[model samples]
Target: MQTNDAFSFLMAWAAAPFRIGSVTPSSATLSALMTKEVGPDTGPVLELGPGTGPFTRALIEKGVRENDLTLIEADSDFAAMLTKRFPAARIFEMDATGLRHMALYNGPVLGAAISGLPFRLISPRRTRLILEGVFANLRPGASLYQFTLGLRCPIDQTLLDQLDLRATRIGHTLLNFPPATVYRISRIPVTKSYDWRYA
Candidate 1:
């Protein structure tokens, strides 16, 4: 596919009703961020809002089995597009917050969530809710991959503390527009509370 075609697809989705605010096509850096950290996608990998599936495609190309991919996309149009693009992968038309209610695979899931959702623009309550659901659904040692143009992800420290999620900078993508940083946050035992990371 031409670069413009792929670029247009991502731009259109980000501008759609869902308000997924990516200013550019997902960068190569964004796609590579988690693959290097997830280290061998041997189990089920859940991708949220896989708009055009940049990360999904990367994961598949890196050795993840087609059947082990479960994508949760909120946009019906995008979900339908993903279904066509990746017939071997499972697609769910649900929001991230509803993850706890869904049926998951029986085997151990790879504790990595590749999030392309626009967390910086979303409300704190909504963000926290989704993180909580992710925490509950994923086993310990599972990590969340999030990238943002801002120096830090907009999630508040209190929210992170409440969910016991700890943040570690995986790397940065200076090639992206406005540049961006990637973080791999995992759940850890917390003895003290912290103020909101956003605050």
Candidate 2:
């Protein structure tokens, strides 16, 4: 990680601890685990809140092309830094929760979404919207990868049910500052049920 990266992350955290989530950028071990499921063949990938590009670097190392990645960062400063660092990537300086209002991005059905967002700090309603937008753009079976400092999944069961999604714990890394676990989220197909009242 670059010295500037840490400094920038610290500044962002100092401004809004809850929004920034972590005081420091994610560790390399955690970054690797979060991007383990994606690659060039996996199609285009979306990265939410890629503050200093730790996971972004890992994804590229995993064989994903820089041009095939879309980075959505709410913070203008981090977004500007990411744009400079990754010239080929599509960087959008917009809120992840506002994805619903954005045009459908041009790409193959997104292979996966690697998030650095602080889902634990976001409200359930907004979290649902962010996820709904993610699912709307992803291909069937595409996974959403997220790392959390908490022992439990950052996303609650109620939201998962509403989205018809399931979370699988990928692995836990004690190497990180506060330790973190990665979860792979996949949408579960919902079967339509017949209503007897109509008959």
Model 1 local distance difference test score: 0.74
Write candidate 2's Cα lDDT for 30-148 as tens digits. Answer: 99889887877997899999999999999999999999899999998999999999999999999998877765566338889999999999999999999988888888889899999
The true-structure Cα RMSD of candidate 1 reads: 6.5
**Alpha-carbon deviation at 17 in model 1, angstroms:** 7.0
Q: Which residue segments of model 2 deviate by more than 4 Å? A: 106-108, 191-199
Which is the leading candidate under TM-score? 2
Error of 1 at 155 (Å): 1.7
Q: How many pairs of residues collide in each model?
A: 7, 0
How much lDDT does candidate 2 score? 0.90
Pull out the clashing pairs in model 2: none
Candidate 2 residue 184 Cα shift, in angstroms, is 0.6
Return the TM-score for candidate 2, rounded to 2 decimals.
Answer: 0.93
Per-residue lDDT for 6-71 in model 1, tens only? 665666755673457764557666688756666464467778878778788888877787777889
Off by over 4 Å in 1: 1-18, 190-199
